[model samples]
Structure formats: C-alpha cells, structure tokens
Target chain A: MIIAIPVEQKDPDACVSSTFGRSGYFLLFDSQTNDFHFLESTFATGQSAGIRAAQLMIDNHVGVLITNRCGENAMRLLSAGNIQVYQTIAGSARDNLERCLAGTLSRL
Target chain B: MKIAVLSGKGGTGKTFVSVNLAYIQDHAAYVDCDVEVPNGHLFLPMDRASFEPVDVMIPSVQTDRCNGCRACVDFCAFHALGYAGGQVIVFDNLCHNCGGCRLLCPQKAIIEHPYNIGSIRTGNFEHVHVVSGSLNPGQMQGSAIIRRMIAQTRPFPNQILDCSPGNSCHVVQGILEADMCILVTEPTVFGANDMRICIELLKLYNKPFGIVINKSLDTRNYIKTFCREQHIKVLAEIPLQPELAVLNANGQLAAKQPEYRRIFQKMLKNAHSLVAPQNL
Candidate 1:
C-alpha cells in the first residue's frame, strides 16, 4: 500500500507539515517495496487547497494519509476515497512512516 | 440617480447615512447591499415585504456516464470538484457557480442545479421603498445577491445603496450600478486610512464621489485634513452626539427627529450636485 505524508521538504528526513492542504511537498512511500518519492503540492496557495491536495492523493492511488491535521472538506474527500488517515507524531517523514508501519501511530 | 454609501472600515456608519438619505427623499429606494449582515431594516422597518430566494447554478455529476474522464475535476478553477473512489464530489460552498464544468463535460453527465444562497426582501416604508438582501449564514455569495438587488431596484429613480465594509468584490458589486457614491467615514486616523482605499477604488472606476464625515467631534480632524489634502469635497458632517447614538441603538431613524432631519436633507442635496452640478 502507498502511504502519503505531507512534508516540509522533498527529503525523507524533512519534518511532517502541520497543515495537510498547504504543505510544500508530499512524500509517497510504498510500504511493500520500502521505496518512496516526492510529489510537489500544486494548490499550496490556491483556493480550496485542501480539496485539491486530497484529490492529488486520490489520483496517486494513496491508500493511507499521515498528517498533523485535516480540514473537514478534505477529510470527507479522503474518506470517500477509502483512504485511511493516521495521526502523525512530531518527527521526520521517515520516522512517521516507520511508526505507521509498526502500527504505533493512531488513526486520525 | 443611484448613490452608493460606502466605508472601507466597519462601524463607520454606512447604514446610518444610507437609511437617512433614503428616508429624506420622496419616492426613493433603500437598497441594503450589505447582504452578509444587513441591518438597514432595523431603522427603516419594511411594511408588507415580499421575499424572493436567490439561487446560483451548481453542477452535479452523473457517475454512470462520467467515464472517469476527470475533465470536470480539472476544469474547475475554484477546486470545488474532487474525484475519489471513481466518483466526483462537488464542494458546493467553494463553487462560484461558473458552470464551466457542466459546459466542458464531454459525457453529458454534468447537469446544473439551482442552489439557494440567499433571499431578497422588498417592501415599502411610507414613501420610501426598501429592498434588503439577506445572505444565508455561512454563504459567500454576497456579490451575487447585491447584483440581483441592484437589478430589481432599477425602476426607482433615487437609490441609496448601503455597501458592506471594505473594498472587496462585494463592495464592487454594490457600487457598479450607482451613478454617484457617498463615502461615509468617521473622524479617526484608522477611519481616514481605510477610506483611502475606497477613494482609490472609486478613482479607478472613474466614479464621482464625495465624503460624509460621521461621528465628528470637531471641525479639524483626521478625515477633514485628509479630504482637504486630496481636494475631495466634504458633503456633510454628523456630530458625535449621545442622543443620536441612543436613538440609533434603539433602531430609531435619526432623520425622523426634527433637528437631524435638516442635516440629512442637506447631505442629500450636496450628494445630488456631485453627479448633477447643473441642478446645484
């Protein structure tokens, strides 16, 4: 399954962005292959950025989303896509991914 | 002629000036374009009011014929559409009712639906016709409602458009149909500063406008100084009186009182000369 984490930077060690919609970059991690890549967020400063960000995750076939917080509209869209949202602890993108894989992170 | 009363800052008495101006005129229409929080009805209570719901077109997708095209989703500039779980979801609030999605839909799956954003209330207060727009709570289509109200009140020769605070798109809609504008402002540094933006907007639109200093404490104040420097005409000044405040707080029309009646009458006459100097 592919997990998406809104990150501050493209690097795996970048801190998870506090905001899901206006995040600068999204780190897409493939849990099965232990591989990952970064995708730049398009609607970071646009209107309804949350909805656009959620749509980006849906288009990329993201099965899980890990972030600090999610807006109501974006949450509804994410839920409609059947993507499980997990709450992330304060740490780097890779650390949150590791915790998510270990089943230690809680569902948001 | 339609005169829009506007102030860039809130609580500068846009409604106060508008209500009085409308009240003083014979066969005038009071248009409350501040739809988000319309309060002109408080002073000029409507009698036998008729309401009409304002609706905007929102697109709905028929998933069966959508074909997973993603055309509508990508076409929306407002990002009001989202595709997930092989289905498209429409965020009604974010949609500006542009109808581009419905037009661009290749599969004929997208259809426009009427969504009620607000209502327009029209009634009579003695000789003055009152038309106020009330936007539904959490709705962001004040501009659309203002436009509709302006169109409806076209037959009335004299109009006082009470604009919402600031130079937002909402204010732009309010001033669009107006022949002249009356900028009501308070005598303060902040009030004078904010009024500059509204002046700039009027200049950009090339609309003739004058200023009315509300809540004035003295002859020499911030608003007066700024207006002099800009060479803008000061139409009238409403004194900062405790009795006026009390009467206004109780939803009483200041123009109804004998003393304040002359003030509004003169203000209206000055505002008339702004657009029609020949009549002066």
Candidate 2:
C-alpha cells in the first residue's frame, strides 16, 4: 500500500503542506518496502490544480492521502478512486505518516 | 456603430450612462454585458420580450464506453476529468468547458453537455431595444454570458454595450465588440488609479476610448488633469446632483431633464464622431 503526504520539501521532516492541491511536492511511502519517493506536483499552473493533484495520486496508486484540506472536487475524485484521504497529524510528514500507518489519523 | 461604456472601478455609473445614452440615441440597441449584476434592465421600462438560457459545454463521460484509458483525464488542464477505479468522474465546477477532454477522448466516451450558466433577456424599453444577460447566482462564468449578450445585439446603427466593472476577461469580451469605448469614471484617487489600469488595457487592445466624468463634485479637476496628461478627451462631465440620484433610484431617466439631455446628446455626438468620423 502507498501512503501520500503533501509536503513542502522532499525531506521526511518537511512540514505537511496545509494545501493539498497546490502543495510543492508529494512524498509517497510504500508500506511493504518501507521506501519513500518524491514527485513534484504538476497542477500548480491551473485553477483545477486540486483535481490534477488528485489524479496524480490516483495514477501513482496511492491508497491513502494525508493533507490539511482537500477541495470538494478533488475529494470526490479521490474517493471515487477508492483512496482514503486522512487529515494530517500534528507535525511533519514523518509524524503524519506514522499516525497514518498506526491507523490513528482522522479520515477526511 | 457599437459603443461600449466601461470603467475599471465599480460604482462609476457605467450603467447610468449606458441606459441614458441608449434611450437618448435614435434607434439604438442597448446591451447589458454586465452579466454578474445586470442593472441596466432595472433602469429601462422594458417588458419581457424573450428569455433564452445561455449554456456552455462541460465534458460528461459515458462510463460504459470509457476503457480506463485515462486520456481525457490527462488532457484536461483544469483537472476536471478524473479516471480512477475503472471509472471516470467529471468535476463540474472545475471544468472550464474548454471541450478539450471531449475532443481528445480516444474511446469517444467523452461527450460535451450543455450546462446552463445564465439567461438573456430582451425587450423594448419604450423606444430603445434593450438586451441584458444575467448570470445565475453563484455562477462564476460571466464571460460566457457576455459573449452571448454581444451576439444577441439587435441590428441598429447605434448600439450601446453597458460593460461590467473592472478589467477582467468579462469586461474585455464586451470591449472587443465595440467600435469605441466610453470610460465612465468618478473624480477620486481610487477611481483614477483603477481607471489607469483600464486605460492601459484599452491601449493594449488598440481600442480608442474617451472619458466621461460622472458625479463631478469639486471644482478641482483631477480626472481632467490625468486625461490631458494622457492625451485622452473628456467627452462630457455630469454634475453631482442629488436629484439625479433620486431620479435614478426610481428607474427614471435623468437625461429626460433638458440639461442632462443636452449633455448626453453631446456625448452621443462625440462618441459617434470618434467611432466613425466619415459618418459625422
């Protein structure tokens, strides 16, 4: 399973981005392999950035998304993809991902 | 000839000028391109002639025909189309109705559907033919209605387009169709600053425009000085009259007063000469 967290930087300690669609980068963590990778967000230029960001997550096979807020359009798209979006925990990507993995984060 | 009445700032009396000018002009058609809040109709004594819904194309996916190709999803710049879980979803609000998704769909699953955004109302406001486009509440697509409003103009020698405030795409749509523009502005610092942007935009578009100082209060001339410095003509100046506001609030044509009638008539003649000097 892949867990995606919107972050400002590629570092695991980077603070979780408050915005889901216009986030600078997305950190993807693979639960089985315990590996992580970063992908630059492509929806920054358009008004539909949120929808495009959700598509990016869907294409990358991200099973779960963690962010501060998600727009209604993006939320509907992600939910239709069978991806669970969770509100971020109190701190960085590392902390949020830990809470996500522990199944303690609130589902958005 | 089409004359557009515009202002970069709101509450500059663009509608007031447009409606009165249309009423004063002989055999003219008045088009209210301010779809967001079309108040021109309120000032006109118009009976509802016709109402037509204005619709824009929004991409709708035929789920059965979609093959999980994800082509449409990728083609949409607005990310309006989403493909996931072997299904496609169209986010109506995010969709710009560009029709790119439908055009690029390899499976032919994407179809363009009409989404009604607003309506156009046309009627006779006494002698002048009036047309106004009004967008539905909460609708963000004012440009679509403006385009429709311009297209719905009656064939007349003189057409007055009452443009919405600001320099947004909605205002540009109306400005583009006019032969000349009458920039109605107030004599104030904020109005001057906002008018500067509009002046720049008109210059960029290569559209010739004149200024109309509405509600001129103080004897000092700030708008006049700016116009002179910019080499733009002041077509007319409407004095600050409490009676005019009272008349306007009651949907009365203040231009009916002989003095204002002469002012608007002069404005019409000036605007005509600027638009078509050959005809003058």
Candidate 3:
C-alpha cells in the first residue's frame, strides 16, 4: 500500500504539516518496494486547495493518507477514491510512517 | 442614472439609504443585490411582485461514455470534478458553472443542465420599481443572480443598486452596473478602515464615488478626518438620532417624515452633480 503524509519539507525527517490541504509537500511511502518520494503541492494557494490536493492523492494511487486534519470536501473525495485516512501523531514524517506501519496510528 | 450604494462594513445603512433614495425619486428601480440576506424589500413593500428563478449551467457526466478519459477532470479549475472508481464525480457546490468541462470533453460524455440557484422578485412600490434577488439556502452563486437581476432592470432610466457589504464578488457585480457609487460609512475607526478599502476598490474600477457619513455624532470622528484628508466629498451626514433608529427598526422609510426628507433630497442633488458629466 502507498501511504501518504502531508509534510512541511521534502525530507522524510521533516515535520508533518498541520494542514492536510495547503501543505507544501507530501511524502509518498510505498511499503512493498520500500521506496518513497516527495510530491510538491501545486494547489496550495489556489481556491479549493483541499479538493485539488485530495485529487492529487487519488491520481497518484495513494491508498492511505496520514495527516493532522482534513476538510469536508477533501474527505469526501478521499473516501470516494477509497483512500483510508489516518491521524498523524506530533512527530516527523519518518516517525509517523513507522507508527503507521506498526498499525499504531488512529484512523481519522 | 444608476447609482450603487456599498459599504465595506455591514449595518452602515446601505439599504436604509437605498430605499429612501428610491422613495424620493419620481421613478426609479431599487435593486437588492444582496442575495444572501436581502433586506431592502422590507423597507420598500411592493405590490403584486413577480418572481423568476435564476439558473446556471451545471455540467454532468454520462459515465457509460466517459471511458475514464480524465479530460473533464483536468479541465475543471474549481476542482468540482474528480476521477474515481473509473468514473467522474461532480461536486455541485464547488462548481462555478463555467461550462468549460462540457465543451472540452473529448468523448462528449459531459452535458450541461440549467440548475436553479436562486430567484429574482420584482414589483412596484408607488413610483419606484422594486427588484430583489434571493439566493437559495446553502447556494454559493449570489453573483450570478445579481448579474441576472441587473440585466432585467437595464431599460429603467433611474436605478439604485443596494450592494452587499465588504468588497466581495457580489459587490463587484452591483458596482459594475452603476454610473457612480455612494459609500455609506459610520464615524468609527473600524468603519473608516473598511471605507478606505472600499475607496481603493472604487479607484481601481475608476468609478466616481462620494461618501455618506451615517449615524453621525456632534463630535468630529475618524470618518470625517479620513474624508477631509482624502479630499472625498461628504455627500450627506445622517444624524445619530433615536427617532431615525426607531423608524428603521419598524421598516419605515425615514424620507417619508418631513424632517428627514431634506437630508435625502440633498444627498440626491450632491450625487447628481458628482456624476452629471459622465452620466450625460
């Protein structure tokens, strides 16, 4: 499964963004391949940023999303795409990713 | 002459001034462009009002023919469309009804339909024709309704557009149809600050505008100082009287009273001189 987390920076050690929709970057971690990459959020400043950001995750085939918060419109789109959303703890993307893999993170 | 009355802050008496201005005119059209919560109709009671639904084109996709092309999904700038489960989903609230998605669909799967978001009510109140735009609850297309109402009232010789507050898109729609604008403001720090923003908007649009100081007190205030420094004419000063408040609260036009008639008449005269050349 591809797990996505809204991150403040490109690095895995970067802190998770408090906002799900307007985050600067998203860290995509693939559990099967043990590979990960950063995708820049292009819709951060535009209207309906949450819906566009959620569309980005859907287009990227992200199966799980870990974030601090989500909006109603974005949440609806994520659910329609069958992407599971999980709440992120107060830590770096790497730390959250570990907790996610260990099945300790709570669903949002 | 079409005059738009706007205020950056609410309760500065946009409707109060609009209804009274229309009341004093021999024949004028009063347009309530504040679709969200229109109150101008309350002050100007009309007889035998006619209503028409305001509709906008909303696009829907025929998924059987869509073929997961993603053309419509990518074309929507409002993010109202999304591709999921090998189909396109339309979020009605997010849609701005731009109609680009239907035209851009390669498979011809998208079709446009007229969706009613609001209605416009028109009636006659003595010499004045009253037109009020009311948006449906939870609808986000007040600007569209305002545009429709303005188009219908174009042939009228004189018009007073009661614009919604705060320099939003609704205000823009109302201001775009006016020959000049009257900014209603109060004598407070917050009121003056908001009036400054409205002044910038008028300057950007190159619309000739003057100020009306509502609820004025005996002492000099921020709005008076700001208007003096900016060289903006103070078209009228409505006194802060308890009687005026009582009349307004009772949905009465202050101009109907002998004491307040002169104030609106002077305001109309001043507004005319300010825009006479351009209007002619």
Candidate 4:
C-alpha cells in the first residue's frame, strides 16, 4: 500500500505541513517495499489547490493520505478514489507516518 | 455619459453617491455592478418586472472522444481540470471559462456550455431606470457577471455605474468602459492610501477621473490635499450628518431631503461638465 503524506519539504525529517493542498511536497511511501518518493504538487498556486492535491494522490495510486487538515472538496475527491485520509498532530513527517502505521492517528 | 463610481476600499460611500446621482438626474440609469452584495435595490423602489440571468460559457468534455492524454488538464491554468483514473474531470468552481481547454484539446472532445452565475435586474425608480447585477453566493466569476450586465444595458443619455469597492478585476471591468470615474473616499489614513492606489490605476489606464469626499467630518482636509497634489478635482463633498447616516442605514434615499438633493444635483452637473467636453 502506498501512503501520501503532506510534508514541509522532501526530507523525511521535515515537519508535517499544516495545509494539504499547498504543501511543498507530498512524500509517497510504499509500505510493502519500504521505499518512498517525493511527488511535487502541480497546484502549488491555484483556486482548487486542495482538490488537485487529492487528485495527485489518486494519480500516484496512493491508498492512504496523511495530513493535518483536509478541505471538504479535497476530502470528497479523496474518498471517491477510495483513498483513506488520516489526520495527524503537529510533528515531523516521519513521526506522523510512524503513528499512522501504528493505527494511532484518527481518520479524517 | 457613462460615469462609474468606484473606490479601492469598502464603506467609502460609492453606492451612497451613485444611487442619489441616478435619482436626481433626468433620463439617467443607475447600474449597480457590485454583484456580490447589490444593496442599491434596498434604497430604490424596484419594479421587479425585468430581470435576466448572467451566464458564461463553461467547458464540457465528451467522454467518448477524449483520449485521456491529460492535455486539456495540463492546459487549464485555473486548475479547473484534472486527470485521474484514466479520465479527465472538470471542477466547475475553478473554471474561468477562458475556452483554453476546448481550443487546446487534441482529441476534439471539449465543448462549451452556459453556466448561470448571477442575475441582472432592471426597474424604474423615481423616473430613473435602474439596472443592477447580483452574483449568486459562493460564485467567483464576478467579472463575468459585470460583463454580462454591460452587454444587456441599453445606452442612455446618462448612466451611473455603481461599482464594487476594491481594486480587483471586477472593479476594473466596471471602470474600463466608462467615460469618467468618480472615486468616493473618506478622510482617513487608510482611505487616503487606498484612494492613492486607485488613482495610480486610473493614471495607468489613462482614464479621466475626479474625487467625491463622503462622510466628511470636522477632521483635517487630508483628502482635499491629496487630490490637489495629484492635480485631481474634488467634485463634491457630502458633510457627515447623523440624520443622513440614519436615513442611509434604513435604505432611505438621503436625497429625499432638500439639502442632499441639491448636493447630488451639483455632483451630477460637475460630473457632466467633466465628461461631456471630451466627447465633443
């Protein structure tokens, strides 16, 4: 399963971004392979940035999305794609992902 | 003569001056272009007999003809279109209706459809024809509504366009086609700053304009000094009166009073003289 986490930067140690749409980078982690890749958001500057960000998760074949907050439109699109979105507390990207894996984070 | 009353900031009395001007002048049309919150109807007695919807062309994709190459998605600058699950999806909210997607679609799958975003109402109030546009709540295409409003408006001998407050695209749309612009401002630091920005915009467009000082209290003449320094005319000044404020808040035309009637008449005369000569 591939998980997409909105992060402040491409680095795993970077803080989890507060915004799901305008985040600097989305870290896509494959739990099965234990590998990760950075997916740059095309909607870095757009009106429906959150919706486009959710579409990015769909295009990347992500099964889960980890973020601080998700807008109504983004949540609708993400849910339509059958991608589960989890809300995490303020922490580094690696820490949030670890909590998400342990099933401690709440589903958005 | 088409005169646009505008301001860079809200609560600067653009509507206050505009609605009154239309009421006092003969054969004048009051066009409220502030579609977001068209409160001009409150002050004027609308006939409610004439109204029309403002619609814009939104793109639609023919699924069978689409190859799902994501070309149209990449072409949309507003991010209104996206490609996922081997299909292209359209977000109507973000669509500017620029027709770029339809023009750039390699597979010839995109088509245009009309989407109503607002309504324009026309009525007779106090012997003056009143036309106003009201945008639907949560709609983002304000400029499109203004454009549709202008297209439907019949040119009269005198027209007063009550523009939305702010230095946005919608305000520019209202100002661009006008023969003259009246920037309504108050006597405050923020008012002066915003008025200066508006002045810069007018100068950039090379459009002729004047100033109307509204709600002038016993404060210093900062607005007068700024206009003088910029070589702009102070068309009229409506003194701050508590009774006038009370009347305005209750949607009553302050021009009903003899004093305000004289003020609006003088303003109309001044604006006509400022705009008429250039046309000659």
Candidate 5:
C-alpha cells in the first residue's frame, strides 16, 4: 500500500502542511490498510478551502488519516466519506507514519 | 494607557501602528503578540535579548498505567486522542492540551508534559522596550504564546500591543486584556469586512475601542463615514504615502518621518482624550 501521510518534509509519499496555508496535506495514498493524514479543519466545512479539501481527500482515495488534530466540521466531512480520523500525534513525520502502519496507534 | 492594535484580517497595518506608536512614545514596551509572523521586529529593529521559552502541555501515554479502555478518546471534544486497539499513539501536535484525555484515561496512562512551542525576545529601541513572541511553524496553537507574552507584563501605566491581524485566538488574547483596542485598517473592501468582524469582537468583549485608518487612501474613505454611523471614534488616519511604505519596508520606523511622527503625536493626544474621564 503506497499510503499517503503527512510529514515534516514534503515528499512523494508525504504531504507536509505548513502552518500558514494550503501546505498541509491533501495527500494521495495508494493503500487503505494503514496510516492516516493530519488535517486542520475550518470551523465550517462550507468554506472554500474546507470543501475542496474534503473533495480532494475523497478523490485521492486515502484509507487512513493521521493529523495533529481535527475540528468538528472537518471530522464530519471526513467521516461522511468513511475516513477514520485519529487525533493528535506529535512526533517526527516518519516515526508516526511507522506507528500507523503497525496499527499501534489505537491505545491512546 | 495600555493600547492594543488589532485587525480581523492579516496585512492591514496592525504592526504599522504598533511600531510607529512605540517609536513616537519612546517609553512604552511594545509587545508583539502575533506569534505566527512577528514582522514588527523588522519595522523596529533593536538589540533584543531572548526571553524564556513558551511551553505547552502535551499528553504522554504510559503503557503500564493505561488499562486499554478507550474512554479518553470517547470523551475528547477535540478528538485529540483515540484507542481502537492495544496501542498508544499520541498526536502531540494535534492536542489542544485541554486535559480531557488525561481525565478520561481509564488506565491512568495519560500524563501531561510540557512542550516548547516557541520563545520570547526582549529588546530596546531607543528607550522603548520591545518584546515579541512567535509560534514555531507548523504549530496551530498561536494564542498560547501570545497569552504568555502578555502575562509577562508588569502593571504599567502605558504599554502598546501590536496584535496579529485576525480575530483568531492570537488577536483575542492580545486584545482581551487591554484597557482599549485600536482597530487598524485601510479603506479597501477587505478592510471594511474585517473591520466589521473585529469591531464586533471588541463589542463582544466590551473592550472600548476606536479606529486608526492606516495607509489611508488619498482620494476619500467611506470607511470613516461608516464608522461615524456606527459611533466609532476615529483616533487617527495616515494617508497612502509611498515614502512611508518604502521606509517601513526597509526596516525603518514610520514615526521617524517628520510627518508620520506629527500624526502619531496628534493621535496620542486623541487616544488619551477618548479614554480619559471627562473632567466634568
């Protein structure tokens, strides 16, 4: 599974989100089996950015999502598409990605 | 006179007013609470000494203490934690440090630990002391650092807070503690919309405020008329002067412009009059 993930460094497998804007991942993942992407949600999913983000996630067919955190509206949008959101995990991008693959992130 | 300068949108003269006001006052401490993009230092360069690091609480999981009950995740309002299987993966960056995770942890494995998000820097520009805090990039929590900088204040007679542009937590924390807030804006459409939001926030907090039209348009402004209709006092206005922008971009204080200095001096007088009790 070529799973997409959010990483500090923006690489082919990782989409790094910058604190400032559109940089946070609207990542593409080949595998749905493991890992999640971090998503910072706007308060309302109706926002242009948020709407496009939700659409992009669905379009890309990402299986799992790992984000630093998520708000209510964003969670609802992602959930509507059957995407599971795991809450804040703050480590270097690679370390957390490995945990997701192992399915070792459930016991918070 | 503790004054806070704010705008609901970014790039609209919040820092301009702050840096110039500090230069004109030459005695007050200038606090830059916009940790996101603290550009005030560029405007008012000084010999700054770094202040203490700003720390935020992040939840740590102790496997031995956790009993595998997913209560913490179920109770999290922010969805900051979860446990679907027998594994503990902490999203430290996602955590808002709200304590729900620790409180709801069935196994008592969750513990809060301090994490450094950013730091503070203090300096002197002429005689005016300047302090600024910036959030580390990729950290969404900007307000915490802004709050930390304000908490460092000593009850002073006069201080100037050059707030971040926006009604986000960073701006609120910077403005909420102020005796008065100064809304800075231009005469454009973006200015009008953002000013309305920011003005509403000030009203929500019941913080007394007036308006300062920075980079004012040379032709005319319906904004001044709009404010008058809404009963907002106009503290000052600075026209779109190319020289001022150039100097400002070059790391020069706008107040150094003979004209700009005169304008702030006049506004300072008006600021006092607006906030001071009438000697009736």
Candidate 6:
C-alpha cells in the first residue's frame, strides 16, 4: 500500500532552499518495499488538497494519508475516498511515518 | 469584473484591499465572503438599505421511515449520519450537502430541508453596494452563504469577493469564480508561503492572478524574489503604512484619501485586464 504524507515547514522563511514556489510535501510511501518518495503540494495549502495534491494522490493511488493536523472537511474528504488519514503526528514526515507504522501515533 | 483578494493565511489585509478597492470603484459591489469573520463592513460604512437571510439545505432523516438497517449510516461517506443499534443521529455540522445519503437510502427516510446558516446585510456605501455575509456561530458550512451572496449581485456589476483565510472551500469558492484574483499578501515568510498556496489553487482552477504586497515591513526581498522566479506580476505594493491600518481600524477606507485614490483606480484598471474584462 502506498501512503501520502502531508508536511509543513517549522519556519519556511528561515530555510534556505527558496520556499517560494516549493510545496510542503505529499510523500509517497511504499509499504511493501519501504521506499519513500515525496511529491510537493502547492504552498500555503496547509492541509487542504489543491490541484497538485489531488492529482498526485489520484495518479499514485495513495491509500493512506499522514499529516500533523488536517482540517475536518479535508479529513472527511480523504476518508470518504477510502484514504485512511493519520493525523496529529508531530514532527517531520519521516518521524510521523515511523510513528504511524509503529502504531503508536494518534490520529485526528 | 469579479476580483477576489485572498491569502492562504490570515491578517494579510484581504478585506482591507477589498474594502478600499470597492470604495474607489464607486459603482461596484463589495461582498465580504469571509462569513466566519467579515470585517469589510468595518472599513466601509453601510447604509443598511436592505438585508436578506441565506439558508443551506441539509438532510434531515425521518425516523418513522428508517428501517433500522443502518443503510443511511453505511452510505454516508462523511459519517454525518450514524446509527448505533437502532437510533440514527445526524451531525449537521459534518454534513457536506453532497446529498449522497438521501440518494442511497432505500426507505427514503432522508429528506432535505433548508437550514439557516447565515444572514446577509446589504446596503449602499457611497454608491457602492456593501454586502456582508455572516455565518451562524455554530454552523460549519459558511461557504454556501458566500456563494449565495455572490449570486445576489446585480447584472454585470464589478464585484470584489473578500475571501476567507486558508485553502478551504471558502477560499476556493471565491478564487474559482472570480475573473481575476488579486492575492493580498505581506513580504513575510508566512505571507509568501501562504500566497504560494493561493497561487497553486488559482493555477488549479486555471485563473489568472497578480500579487499585491500589503503591509510591507520595509523588507520584501523574499516575496519579490519568489515572484520573480515564478514569473508572476507583482501588482501595487502597499507598504506597511500604520496610518492606513489605523484608519481601517477606525472604519475608514483608504481609497477615501485623495492621495491613494489613484492607486485604487490603477488597481481597478489592472483588474480589468484579467479575465472577464467586460464586467469591468
């Protein structure tokens, strides 16, 4: 099962890699192979799925979503599409995923 | 021409630009679609000529026809309708108005009816129509009233939709329908970051937009550099003028000032150049 992880910057401006047009993250996680590939979501999307976010999820057939804190509407939408949303996992994408797979993170 | 001033984040002066722009335009309609907290009415004094109520349709299932099969609960993708044993509960706030449960129910117990989610205040402001949409405090679906407010405009009128914060349905609803979206942003990391989210949604909707840097903190290198690399047009730059902010706080439109009238006029001109120029 491939999963999608939503990410945000602790402070984008402080980061040096031009957070201008860059996205947070819509990472692709291969559960079977344990390989992680990320797709960027458009900036300021926060947790909402914009065009790129939806497109990436649809194109990649993401079955699960991991995020820090997602909006209620977004959680419902993703859940409706059978995408399991794991929320309230604090920290970076890698840390959250580890927690999610370990079955120790709380979901909103 | 419908112009939406939006940002992915809050406090970037979306309503500020919207109120002043509408004031300067004179004949235009200004709609504060930020139903959760519509502040546009603060800057522009309205005459309260007329006001109307807006309602949204929500599903209300009749228990008599419910077979206790839990069919409605199973069909509801939003978990809005839930059944534990026999009794079914409808969480109105979670309902998205998608009408999926009603269609899927075999007993036909799910009936749709209008729910009063908000009210709209319509008034004349110096020849401009000032409209404010206020959502019911506990209601979650404020975007429906926003759309209704947009639909109530006069024929071929230049309108400015002062959108809400974030990329929720409210923001997208404003951005998707507007002719041109004038993104109100600041030069901060959070501002530009939020603007970038707005830009993605606009691009997704295939709408053209320009950036309006508001409340410039005398440092705009990051935002300008980002816009430069993205090939986006940087529109009028409104510096962090505390005088304008104070004036706005006191329910005054900056466009009322003789010195800044030209800026609003030019913004109107720029807005006219975007999609739906005929509306301008």
TM-score for candidate 6, please give it: 0.70
- The Cα error of candidate 3 at residue B195, in Å, is 1.4
CA shift of B52, model 3, Å: 2.5
Q: What is the C-alpha lDDT profile of model 1 across B118-204, one tens digit per residue?
A: 999999988899999998997776788898889888888889999999998899987778888999899887898889989999998
Report the C-alpha lDDT of model 2 over A59-99, residue by residue, as the tens digit.
89999999999998789889888999898877999999888
**What DockQ do you compute for every candidate structure?**
0.88, 0.74, 0.65, 0.50, 0.06, 0.03
lDDT of 5 by residue, B103-189 (tens): 777677888899888888888778778888888886767778777777776454568898878787778886777878889888889
Residue B217 of model 4, lDDT score: 82
True contacts kept of each: 0.95, 0.91, 0.59, 0.36, 0.00, 0.00
User: Which structure among the candidates has the greatest DockQ?
Assistant: 1
Docking class of 1: high
- Which is the better candidate, 1 or 5, if ranked by DockQ? 1
- Higher-ranked by DockQ: 3 or 6: 3
Task: Write down the TM-score of every candidate.
Answer: 0.92, 0.89, 0.91, 0.91, 0.71, 0.70
lDDT tens digits, residue span B1-280, model 6: 7888888889988888898888776468998999998888777778855777877778887888988776776676555664432456666876778888888888998899987777999888777888898987877778788888888884636889999989988888887678889988887789988888888888998888888888876664788888899988777788777788788778877887887777777776776666564544
- Supply the TM-score for candidate 5: 0.71
Q: Model 6, clash count?
A: 3
Cα RMSD (angstroms) for every candidate in the order listed: 2.3, 2.6, 2.3, 2.4, 10.2, 10.6
Name the regions of candidate 5 deviating beyond 4 angstroms.
A1-108, B276-280
When candidate 5 is compared with the true two-chain complex, its DockQ is 0.06
Clashing pairs in 2: none
Q: What is the lDDT of residue B57 in candidate 1?
A: 87
Decreasing DockQ order of the candidates: 1, 2, 3, 4, 5, 6
Model 1 regions lying over 4 Å from their true place: A9-11, B276-280
